[model samples]
Target chain A: MLRSLLEFSGINPLRLRMSWVSASEGKKFADVITEITKELQEIGPQQSYIREAV
Target chain B: MNVQKLKEEAARALGRKDVKYLIGYKKGSYGFRVSPAFIEPKEDIDQLIMSPLCNMSLVKYVMMEETLPGLTEQALKPSKIAIVARGCDSRAINLLIEEKGVPRDRLYIIGVSCQGVIDQRKIEARFPQVTEPAEVTEENGNYIITVQGQSHTVPKEELLAELCTVCRYPTPLIYDKLIGDKLAARPFHYDEIAAFEALPLEERLAYWQQQFSKCVRCYACRNVCPRWYSTICSLDSLSPQWLRRSADTSENFMFQIIRTFHLAGRCIGCGECERVCPMNLPLMKLNRKLEKDAKELFNYESGKDPKAKSLLTTFHTEDPQGFIL
Candidate 1:
């Protein structure tokens, strides 16, 4: 719902990501962060939702 | 519809020696307002009235009394509280009981079969200048609103609340003495949600940003929520403030997200949060989105079955895990 709300407000929801990272899964955690970074890069900056007046 | 019978039931409940008081609706001081009335004595039952305008959830008051400070178990004798419950209010009561927020034994529920409630905002907008108290009665799908000794009849659809229009449960799911005949449950409809879901991500984000930007963060939505029974809300923690006092869009978004997430499987869809909202934010859309997703993803509906545990609390191996990755 939050993601949808953000998306509705014209923000790039891909900028936010959630993943299950276990204590011992160091490699998996690194892979998740790398994937999210790539995704955010592709989405570019969040605009429109953030008003200029504010 | 039968005011006499309703008053009679309230009188009987209030007459009970063990009943602390009866919480119901009464005529407001001014036009079209239905205030929650606390009936302690049998004589006070006469003041109780049930109408299309009695849309306020009484379950919040029950939760309030349960958490009231200085009311230790030994301080006051344990007594049952008789409450006039509509469909949503009963569900809230059941949810509270299931969550162990309130004891089931401490309530005497008098259920009223609702035919949808009128939106006060809509009514006030229609009749903007009525300062004196007005009486509105429903008849043959029309609201006969009398203001200043002049009667004007309006179609029910013109004033019916959006939530009520799509309400599935019109009769109380749990009640000791049901007053009116049970109403047939409406079929589920998610057209609004589907339309929103079909929108492109950017547009969706833009729409919510605009709505959320106007939020004043009054916390009325949290305060009116029957399930928000916690003594200290997570949003109000001083050690780590989840939400800042600044009413900026980003912080407001965070506040809304946190609040809605807390009610993921617990919101009863009473629409009180949206009704109490001063800014008239479409809070129900966010809540109903969760409701829709919870139903589709987990095959769960909150406050429907009293026997079932909350969705987040209980888990099965076969539960949908598509989002886990």
Candidate 2:
């Protein structure tokens, strides 16, 4: 629903991704993270949507 | 609808022993404005009026009234309050009851069947500099507007509020006493949201970015929301994760988008936020998009079913997992 909201607001919904992996399955977690990171690289930073208040 | 009949009903509610006062629309001080009138028992109900110009949802006032616990200066709070409701306002009341904000028994609903309301800005723009008080009546797809002893006819489509154009419900869903004829509602439509969805992702972002940039961070949109009067409102917290007071794009987007999410399954599409917005933002776009998605994806429509649990409140094992991997 969060992803849907982001897309509705014109932000790339790809910025949000959720996955479920067992606690012991470190390999599966690492693989999922890498896949999301690749997708984020293509989608780029949500530059227009987010500017951290730093 | 007969104004006299509405006034008589208002008098009846005001005369109730438990009802503190009755709230209805009265003629505004100036042109094309309708003010919410609070009536006492002995007061004249003749002041009450309902026309296409009464464009706001009165449900917010019922919630805001609670914040004024001792408004009457009496030791005991008023047991019940009477309010005039349109179709959307009735929906809002039901949503409030579903959220347990206000008890249904504590309210005396005077539901008025609404055909549509006029957009004040649209009408004012169309007829600039009409300082005199104006009156409006709907007649056969046109508005018979009378101002300063001159009557003019304008097509309803030219001044009808945007949300009213696509309203699926024009008759109040709940009421102790109903006034006027029950109106036949238009079938559900989300053509605009569908078209917006077809646009490129970047284009959609650009469009909303421009709109959000125009936002001054005036909380009128927040303040006017019927579902916004919670004890622990999320965005105003001192926590770093919450939205700050600044009017930058990041903060504006955060405030508007996050607020929209909070109102996901509760918004009745009253168009109050968009109407009260100083920047004239298309605030309804975010709301209607979610409304469309909730209907299409979850088969849920807010304010349609009073007995059913709210969309966010209830969960099912069969809920869609397509978004998750």
Candidate 3:
């Protein structure tokens, strides 16, 4: 719900990312891109739904 | 039955040369309030009492002992502080141990089998302007309260704290001495959070906005959190401040998220944050939501074991990559 809100307000959900950065894993990036893409899809077409919502 | 035996056991523990003190509860000056008592002598054991009013989580003071500033030279070592801990308080101890915040040997915990504590707010609401000291005892199905020389039989539902509704662990997981009969653990339920989430997105945002606006940036929630005792909190880090000092909607939102995220896998569901919040924000809604997510996604529960690592800190090779890629 919150991601959609930000995305609807023209803020890129992809930009406002939350990642679990491990202190031990300094440079592990095997799944960073995939995670970003997945989050983007979840933030789907919020402009229409959010407008109706607001 | 168990209360007296518990006192005898504590007195025995205190008699030992190595034992420093026994922490217990005593009657407070006001209605439905209990204060922590540090008993070093056998006579002081009589002053301790446990009732529905003894809702305080004494695990916080385990790390609260006064320590000297910055000098590597030690004048004295840490004392073994024995405390009366309930289920939730025991979890705090476990969390501290998990984070290496406190050594296990240094703590002598007298664990109590908790029967859900009363919500002081609820009781106060039902009996406002109470001047005299009062008592709340659990009976067959109701709480018998004696306030101002009048006895009132209140329904359990009216005085029970919301966290008690879904508590799955009523008895302490770890203890050196035990108190009270072990009650059966209840099941976890997120009915309140689910109901809140059922609201429309706009309404949900509005509800949160109203709640967040009332926040005075007192940091009471942060101060009371057992998991948030970093010498330098991330919120105060100037190198790259994640949250701005300004108390605007954006900043408040960021602060809340940051606080919740920090406790993603570390929150023990003690409800201390909600209890200490002066604004009375439904902060637990956010926390329980994250807790529910962490449970579903990782199959993990925080503070279950001291040796267990935090979810964020520990990752698996077969970690779900579907979310990112």
Show the colliding residue pairs in model 3: A34-B324, A34-B325, A35-B324, A35-B325
Please, what are the lDDT tens digits per residue for candidate 1 over residues B1-325? 7789988888888777878888999989988888999878745567888889887999999888878788877654547999999998888988898899888889999999999999999999999978888888899999999999999999999999999988989999999889889888788777898888788875677777788889999899999999898887778887787667788888788888888888888998999999999999999888888888788878888888778898889889998665555
- Worst 10-residue lDDT window, candidate 3 chain B: B70-79
* Superposition error at B73 for model 1 (Å): 2.1
Task: Kindly give the stretch of ten consecutive residues in candidate 2 chain B with the minimal lDDT sum.
Answer: B68-77
Chain A vs. native, model 3, TM-score: 0.42
What candidate 2 gets wrong by more than 4 Å, as runs, is A50-54, B69-78
Output the better candidate (1/3) by lDDT.
1
Looking at model 2, residue B223 earns an lDDT score of: 90
- On TM-score, the candidate that comes out on top is 2
Write candidate 2's Cα lDDT for B1-325 as tens digits.
6788998888888888888888899998888988999988899888899999999888888898876655553632467889999999999988888878888887999999998999989999987888877999989999999988899999999999989988878999889999989888778889998888899987888898899999998788999899898777777778654777888888899888888898887788999999999999998989988888788878897887567799988888988888887
Clashing pairs in 2: none
Looking at candidate 2, what is the lDDT of residue B80? Answer: 85
* Residue-level lDDT for B210 in candidate 3: 70
User: Which candidate would rank higher by DockQ, 1 or 2?
Assistant: 2
Q: Could you tell which candidate, 2 or 3, scores higher by lDDT?
A: 2
What is the DockQ of the complex in model 2?
0.71
lDDT by residue for model 3 (B149-235), tens: 889998888889988778878888878877777887676687776676567666666676677777777788888887777778878
Q: Provide the overall lDDT of each model, using Cα atoms, as 2-decimal numbers.
A: 0.84, 0.87, 0.75
